[model samples]
Target: MANNQTLIPVAEPVIGDKELAYVTECLKTGWISSLGKYVTTFENRFADYCNTQYGVATFNGTVALHLLAAALNLGPGDEIIMPSLTFVATANAIQYTGATPVFVDSEYGSWNIDPAVVEAAITPRTKAIIAVHLYGHPADMDPLREIAQAHNLLLLEDAAEAHGACYKGQRVGGLSDAAIFSFYGNKIMTTGEGGIIITNDQALSERAFFLENQGRYSDNPYWHPEVAFNYRMTNIQAAVGVAQLERIADLITIRQRNAAYYNQRLAEIDGLTLPPNQDWAENVYWMYSVLLDDTLPLNRDELRQKLRAANIDTRPFFYPVHQLPMYDTKQSLPVAEDLSRRGINLPSGATLTIAQVDYVCDELIKILT
Candidate 1:
């Protein structure tokens, strides 16, 4: 490893001039708060991009989930099924409503929730199934959708990392009863920090909007019918979002291209398993993830330390939510644990260049050899 090498970030947002212009307009007009044209524009455009009929913008992804939970009347007695191998917010959202989040294992093929396991995990109390498009790969939704319909359970997507990803021919965010997306600094798109819930159900959309705005009805602004949180996305955030949405295709394309290059270089490496893109899915490759095979002499953490020493940044896969201290249930989901232990997210930001990818791979090969 050389001492003069530049560090590459694991993920980064792509911002442009349109974002600044939109925000500046918001400022000149004194519409800095959530009330502004950009808000609705971003909501509608993003919803339309995802092939959804409506979108309810939120301060962040977690609140979007909470709002959805609240809108659905999910409470203490109910349960929602989701893959254990996901960001904590997925489970936290359901937990916020006093509803239980039942954890399931992931399948090897796509590194997403196993539809078979999901079906097995369902119980009478289960009200919904959330299929997160983990690391940009869509979960096998058709089977999950079938299971949901047969049992009369709602299906949802946590597509925080999977902007523009698609299943079969249809885009995400509209595949199920509803879906949520994050526009944090690290997501494929950036709004600085924001989120949205997209769905075709007009009732759910209206209810979510009502809940996010403190449950206030327009006719009675001062009279709040029910207690709800103020979870509105700022005009500034939406300004950035609308700008990013305009370049959404480029954002997705560059990442996919980078992933292809990574796959080309890393595929022959015996101990590395490249990210998956199923035939039925169009992966956005939100993060070019690879798993460390047991055949590798060094473990995942050991390799990460080596890459860090070489001035190339990386991130380990998230700890399955169920294994976290608060959510610990002594359940043994072998697949998720194994993947978490071995998976690594390389510098997958949109701005990364080919030379940077070459440098990272060179260092990795040296370390592995």
Candidate 2:
């Protein structure tokens, strides 16, 4: 165990002076509600940053996806295909629409939804495919796009973990028909608790905006065309978002540098598989994850315990959605199941220092060795 008592966190929001100033201004101006210039500014700036035509901010990422489902008119018999390895919110969003979520396995190469498995899973009931950019790496989008195009299905991206990640020289959010981003505190850019839907389709953008604000159109006051949700992001959250967006490039750089340092130090260690660095993709390393080789003496949980004892915090990867009690099934998914058991997220916070990374890595190596 380290002599130093300073606890290294697994993930944290990097709130700087700009965030404080913007939030303070929002409070001083009494624009802390959903109706404020900060919300509009944040939507526009974030949309522009992602190379999208429009952005509709929402209360959170899950609600942003739920709004997308509502806009798409998904319900009852409609089915949405997604990887079983991602956060439950992805599947839950589809479920909220009264739609069934079809589980697909992830690719071992990138640890994202396997496009090859997607085609076989699609049926007449399939409405769309939610390709998640898992662990900051973009999924193999070209083939997924081709599949969507061939089947006349909408291709959506879950870019919750990939703020600045890119695939084949294009941004992940712009590559799909529409994409959702989570601005949760631990994400690369934070809005305290918020999300945004980015799309090139004006109709979808307008519908999302309308549905997010209690189904009442701005032009038509007190007229409810249909049941909707109050999923609007508050001005305070947007204020923080604008500031975080301003520093996103720098934040991404810091994460990349930290990941590189970890790679250098941990690559030589046996019984560990580092996160992938694809030639066609630039991963943002949202959480620097590794899969413990089966040969390792310690299991993933055991290793985490050892790391914690050394004052180095870590997190386990998400369990397969299909395996969860809420969506229990007999269907077998070998890759996702294997990854869930073996993968562990090291401390990859953007604010983490090089020395801190070294300490975490040294302790990790010591435990593994």
Candidate 3:
């Protein structure tokens, strides 16, 4: 177990001296709670980065999604459409608001919600569509936007995996009516553990902010008129986030470089299909995934085990939410089901080196051959 097969984790969070120093500074300043300069600074800077008019920081990404559902007033008897291939949070957010989540399948190529399926799922009760840009790839927003427009439904972007990504030259966070971003430990960007909701509408922004901070108005922090959850991001966490935001461009560039290397090295394998991107999409490559053809000698789990045996770390694709225990009542999503069976996540942390990438690809190819 101690030979060349030492594990290379699929993702690693980078917390350099800058982040630590900022946290120390925040601690010394006695402004470590949610109400501090760093928290406001982080929100402002992140809003600017997303090119949106406002950003409301939350404790984590799930809270952001919940807040969005609440802010949009999606509740019992309403319906929301989203891809079943995403993290369960996407669907659970709807359930939190007492709304039903209509699961849609992914397009075979990009692993995003298929527009056709979305069109088919829309009904009179459909109030919104959460177009999640799964695994850092931008969903085809143009057509989805058209569909939403035609039906008079809100299009919300779940850009949790797509920081720094763009669709047709527009930033992902501001491309839809409202967008949510996650800064989880393994995400493309990190605020230690935080999220932001971006919007251009002042009223929506105000509602989102209010919901995020226990429904307390900025004018009267101590007085709460409505019941709201405490989802505010702390100043200490925001300090780390501000530092991470400063280096996001560089982080995205490195991830792109690593993904390109993987593509170049693994493109020749007979059993694998690489990620798909639209001509107009500026993908940030949050995670580099591959699909295993059934014609291949080995299946996805077999390939993953072989790689793990060789010290390379990889992850099996997300299990479609429809298949999960809690979502057994949801409708079937064939495309998402198929992708879940075929896909695998390769090592794609921000700190992955060229040599490490080569090692992962080399091991992957060896198993297939």
* Over 4 Å off, model 2: 1-3
Q: Model 3: which ten-residue window has the lowest total lDDT?
A: 1-10
TM-score (C-alpha, index-matched) for candidate 1: 0.98
lDDT by residue (62-82, candidate 3, tens digit) is 899999899988999999999
Per-residue error for 117 in candidate 1, Å, reads 1.0
lDDT order of candidates, top first:
2, 1, 3
How are the candidates ranked when ordered by TM-score, highest leading?
A: 2, 1, 3
Tens digit of per-residue lDDT, candidate 1, span 1-369 = 232256788988877789889899999999999999989999999999998899999999999999988999999989999999999999999998999999999999999999988878888899999999999999999999999999999999999989999899889888999999999999999898899999999999999999999899888887888999899999999999999999999999989988999889887688898899889999998889999999998999999998898888999999999999989978999999999999999999898887888888888788876
Compare the candidates by lDDT and give the number of the best one: 2
By summed lDDT, the worst window of 10 consecutive residues in model 2 runs over 1-10
Better of 2 and 3 by lDDT: 2
In terms of lDDT, the poorest run of 10 residues in model 1 is 1-10
lDDT of 2 by residue, 11-104 (tens): 8999989999999999999999998999999999999998898999998999999999999899999999999999999999999989999999
Candidate scoring better on TM-score of 2 and 3: 2
